[model samples]
Target: MSSVRRLRPVWADATPDPAGRPVQLSLDELGTPLAEVTFVVVDLETTGGTPAECAITEIGAVKVRGGEVLGEFQTLVDPGGPVPAFIQVLTGITTTMLIGAPPIEEVLPSFLEFSRGTVLVAHNAPFDVGFLKAAAARTGHAWPGNKVVDTVRLARRVVTRDEAPNHKLSTLANLFHATVTPNHRALSDARATVDVLHALLSRLAPLGITHLEDLATATDPVPEDVRRKRTLADGLPDGPGVYLFRGPGDEVLYVGTSTTSLRQRVRSYFTSAEKRGRMIEMVRVAQRVDPIPCATPLEARVRELRLIAAHSPRYNRRSRFPERMPWVRLTSEPYPRLSVVREVKAGDGATYIGPFSSAATAQLAVEALHETFPIRQCTRKLPLVAAPGASACVLVEMGKCGAPCTGHQGPGAYAEVVDRVRHAMVADAAPVVEAHADRIAWLVAQERFEEAATVRDRLGGFLRGASRAQRFAPLATCAELVAARRSDDGGWELVLVRFGRLAGTARVDRRTDPRPAIATLQSTGEQVEPGVAPATAAHPEETDLILAWLGKPGVRLVAVDVPWACPVRSAEGLGDPATAVAALVRPRLAPDDGAPVVRLPGAGTERELDIAEARPVTLELDDARVIPFSIRPPRTA
Candidate 1:
């Protein structure tokens, strides 16, 4: 394809190639600015194809400033309804997954905050960027107007087409020999893209793609005004509430919120003559401005929280310790028990709190509630286990106990205390809702229709929030119970549960076996029984060699372990010294022309599959079983 036809003229000043076709530049030829530009690597998993037609299921993006990882943001969005089965499987996001998640209206703001003030980077820029634009348009916010770098195009420029058979993310990962953890997860994939960027940069270093601005402009154009606006946003409100700035091309220079009056505060940046230069420059980039009026101070606080958590404006601070936050999770048992744990273990049950840093912090909170509510912390499993003869133990001796452990307190009485403790933990929501409802009722009775309508809105918001919290509590617990990323003596392990049952586990094995094969190789260079069919006239070799032994007997899982040593001295010049083998047995293998058949453990049936895709292939019967296989790539010179 010609360069002119490949490049789309999306910008006003975009010039066509010499042939009047779109131009597609390679990494080596494309201009990159090393200084004065920041890049935001982004990825998103959604409900359907088009952003207008579907909703975002998950979003993960990282900001890079000065070629270093400056910040990151990731969240599982509540797309608000059932996600298709294929999408759920592809993204690992289920309909049950986002039940109580905050809606897009709230989530978009947090996303913006992370993406603000930088050029976007993605594998296929049009796909991700288009979706984002559509999402912004759907919401009340203006579509994001920023430059984007498509890594797919960059990869094509960095190496010969033959070097990478297909330019998929997986293929590039293999080419770079990149170590990507949690492969399908949004964060892990984004990290891999970043690595690819660095590798491509090294290859294209001589192409004048070194500077930040040059690279940014080379990939996509950024109007000069957007830069000035960002410069002047430095003094704006740091509190939670919305702020809107207009720029060129219906450009939403920034959509954000501050905990304080960000608008009044932002304008103060232009009060001085010296600051006017920067303010004027920002205004030149922007075209309009607006703000939504907030009712209560608490509502303002929450709105700011929603915006920061959503838009992640350029000036907003990145999350300090998102995974360290505490959350409550319900155990996957007959009677679900709540326990406190950290966000890193979000998929684990046992309601979490603090993601609070220390046990003392969590304990202090429990104690504060205990002082007011008199709730028992003792185990209900063996209520009398605490004391030998007495009805109650030391807890009763102290003023802190309601004495439920010994049955001294009835279930009804204990329940009341438990309710109070729960309130202390999350703060009571009922009272707030009831108060708002009461105010609305008074307004209605007084016939103040407009005021009543306003009060009704407040009440509706509170009720809706309560409903979401209830739904989320259960769904969050379910997710926690069904999946978990754990660490064992061997290495890392991922557990998958089904309907609260431990279904399977995927683990990495670091050990390798050393042995040689006693299995036979046919005279015509294939593994088969003698005289089953007419043999080939030519035979490459009849020698016997051994390969590694690996297995995962617990589940339909894939486990790969690097081979310890080469099985044969003759198979040396094949490139990688360590070989890999994989095995999958199900639904019996179909008849094929050249595939080798491997017998099942019980001699029940046979299965045919690729040796390369198999992690463990059975070719021998020894304890340190070694499978004989060729390590040669067919000669084509």
Candidate 2:
């Protein structure tokens, strides 16, 4: 995207203009007079409320300029099927009447011709306009670039509750004393709306809104204080960045970012497009907008996260809370068992898999792992050597637990279970997936579909959380890595990451070599310390944003301080956890063609697993595919 040079806010101390240059204003400032602008009052009758599935049965429009009718256009369209009885009663246009009429293909071009070069006016603009635009897309016609006005919004701005109980078309048409009444027919409602439009414009005339362009502010009338504060957005750069609306005493009121243009995004807060009531309150109290421009979209997103975290602005509620989700951790102790916790400390030497949405999900995932490895489920800590005279629980008698806490199972035997649990968390997941597959089949054979589904979901959540942690581990472990991708503007977008945190970013023009830029980035980048998990080093959301950008098609690694690799890589293409589990259970992960399957007590027997029954191996993100996107000049394979 193109960018404008950053300058001081409009309310800042006045700077004298350059001697020869004259001030230029946008067309919006000196707008076209309302009397000179032509408007097409339109309404539509459709088979249903949804535009995507429903077909338009009729179109009605009346073109007017300076309170005088110029022409009228009306058509009954064949919607290619029988109209529902409810719609027939509401519209009074029967399926029999539509059978002999022209289809949308024949009627649309004529309607477009009649309403060309005029502003569109409708009671509820989105409803009427949505159907028209959907029709255009369905019939291979380009939608027109006409401005639209919603009379309902106009009445809500100007009409008082005492004079009109509601802003509906019938209420407004009767209040304005129109010659026609709205009866849900296309042409009748269109003519009634024309009278309502004239009355609403007259009310707006005294508010200094005499031009067509000024109608935007009047339709959903902006408070005068908020309107004057639009100057706060002036001189903001039209580039990707974070913008903070600061209140009195220099406290940040809200923080927002735009991947396209900071200027446009900040400016929108003062317009009708920003409908949130709290945001409007934030804008009203806002004294200034501070724009923090960055080299790439990834940097802008990271900066936004950091600002929201630091300030905890009242209006920014979406991400105001810290990332405190639960993670299923393998405790680093004598007899390792699964435990769920929020905080992660570096160098713990325990397998960590999650950042699950809730503690319940983390616990369910833990149970799935326990189904394969008979790890202890008790919460109390166990010593290196079990306590003397400790009694074993019934779980040991049931063969569900090794009862390491009571010394019945030695540390050496418990160590074997811990290793397999670690491997399932960090490496291959076929073992856990296979164990659940056998139970699900047995449950289904017993006609227990709900239990089978529960088993399926538990396995899905476990693999997904495990896969996600494995995905972030490689990037979190690497101390320093620099990558680059071809920017949309034919330039290089350089990204510098340290221990999974976005350390720095830079943009190089098409004509410049990025090597020097990369060198400067390394020196200027944010210094970070690597942590045991990605969340320990940085916010999980921030890591997710950086990973998403880096994993895109054009991204290439320029250099790395160490080898970066993950064990639980995708076998098929990118997909959700449910699909991943299905592939693992059915045909994808079956033991065939020399593939090893662990022989467990409850898991399937050593039956010859059909190789063809397995899902095709996941979309490879291994070295063979990743090497192509890596442009590091001197790296050993």
RMSD of each: 32.5, 12.7
Model 1 lDDT tens row, 1-637: 0011111222112234575533223222212333235677788788887867888877777666433466777778888788999987887888887888777788888777667767888988888888888878878897567777888887776667779887887788777765553366676777677667666655544443444433432332223334324334433343334666655564445554443555444543322322444445555656556564442222343344444544544434434333443433333332223444453232332332222334444444443333334555553443323344547667577666756555576666665655543442333433333333334333333434466444434333323322222322322223212121222344333333211122232333435211111011011112222210011111101000000001133322222222122112111211111111111112123334454444322222222222332322322211243333322221110
The C-alpha local distance difference test score for the whole of candidate 1 amounts to 0.45
> Local distance difference test, per candidate?
0.45, 0.74
Score residue 171 of candidate 2 by CA lDDT.
95
In model 2, where do residues sit more than 4 Å from their true spots?
Answer: 1-143, 149-218, 221-231, 320-323, 441-457, 533-536, 568-575, 587-637
Q: Encode model 2's per-residue lDDT on 1-637: one tens digit a residue.
A: 0111221212111233365221211212223557667889999999999997889898888887655577788889899999999999988989999878999998888888887899999999999999988888889999987999999988888899999999999999889887788999998898889878877877766554555646766656577677556667667887899999999989999988899888767767766777899999998888999999987889999999999998999889755545567788998988888989886766787778877777888888998887767788888988878778888777677667888988878989989888888877877777776677566544543445567567767776787678668778778888888999998779999999999899999999899999999999999999998777645477777888988998899999999997777753431132443344344443323333453332222222232223232321211211121101111111110
Which regions of candidate 1 fall more than 4 Å away from where they truly are?
A: 1-32, 216-637
Q: Which ten residues in a row have the lowest lDDT in candidate 2?
A: 626-635
RMSD of 1: 32.5
Alpha-carbon lDDT of model 2: 0.74
Number of colliding residue pairs in each model? 62, 11
Candidates' TM-scores?
A: 0.30, 0.63
